[model samples]
Target: MVKVEFAAALQRHVPCAPQSVAPGTLRAVLEAALAAAPGLAHYVFDDQGAVRKHVAVFVNQQQVRDRVRLDRPLADGDSVFVVQALSGG
Candidate 1:
């Protein structure tokens, strides 16, 4: 199973916990995790189902490059971290 964790900053708004989801593409893993806290989907994804511009997702410490497709493959035991990106001066 893939281990998915939301950053503390993000959790403050939606209150989600780290969870293990079936190994699959990034989209699948996110869907499983969000199932527990459906409201969180709004913070992570935009209206078109693409990752929000202010959100970032990392797999095994590497940042994912495809925000729109979210096709990055995840394997069992892989660690996925979702965080709200900081911006502004």
Candidate 2:
């Protein structure tokens, strides 16, 4: 199972910040997640399906820098966290 978490803003679409999902690549996992929660795509990604500039993802606690790398493989029991990044000066 892949555990997914979202920031509070994302919770409006998925009440469960932390959700378990079937195993798949990061792309597949995110696609399935968007299908499950239609509203989330707009909130997390841009029209071209790239992760929003303000968004960040972590797989097994390691930050992912390449949004195009979504097709990267994911192992079972891995935790996937999607959250909006905070910025301030």
Candidate 3:
């Protein structure tokens, strides 16, 4: 199973706990998560269905490069973390 977690910043907007999901692309897994926390989708993606600029996604401790596509494949037991990135000084 793939584990997905939302940072404290996102938890404030939608009360969700870390979840375990079937292995798939980052997009597919996050889409599943959106179903569980319907209200959290908007905070993670933009109107264009892309990850928001202020958000960061990490798969097994490696940061993802494609914020728009999120096609990065996931493996069983991989840990996915979505966090709000810090900006400004």
Candidate 4:
């Protein structure tokens, strides 16, 4: 199973906790997580099913480059971290 975790900063806005799920592509795993926490979908994804601009998804410490398509595959035991991207220099 893949472990999905929410960053501390994002947890302030939503109730998503660390969870384990079946391995699949980034989109598939994310959709499954959203099903478990219906309300969290809006904060992570946009109306067109794309990851929100402010959201960052990392798989096993590597940033997901395909934000629009989210086709990156996840293997068993992988860790996915979801965080709100920070801006402003």
Per-residue lDDT tens digits for candidate 1, residues 1-89, read 99999999888998988989999999999999999999999989999999998888999998886899988788998999998777874
Ranking by TM-score: 1, 3, 4, 2
Candidate 1 deviation (Cα RMSD) = 0.8
Off by over 4 Å in 3: none
Using all chains and alpha carbons, the TM-scores for the candidates as numbered come to 0.95, 0.84, 0.95, 0.91
lDDT of each: 0.91, 0.79, 0.89, 0.84
Which residue runs of candidate 1 sit more than 4 Å off their true CA positions? none
| Model 2 clash number | 0
State the local distance difference test value for candidate 4: 0.84
Q: Candidate 1 has which clashing residue pairs, if any?
A: none
Residue lDDT tens for model 4, 5-74: 8888767867777788899998898888767777888888889988888888988898886778888888
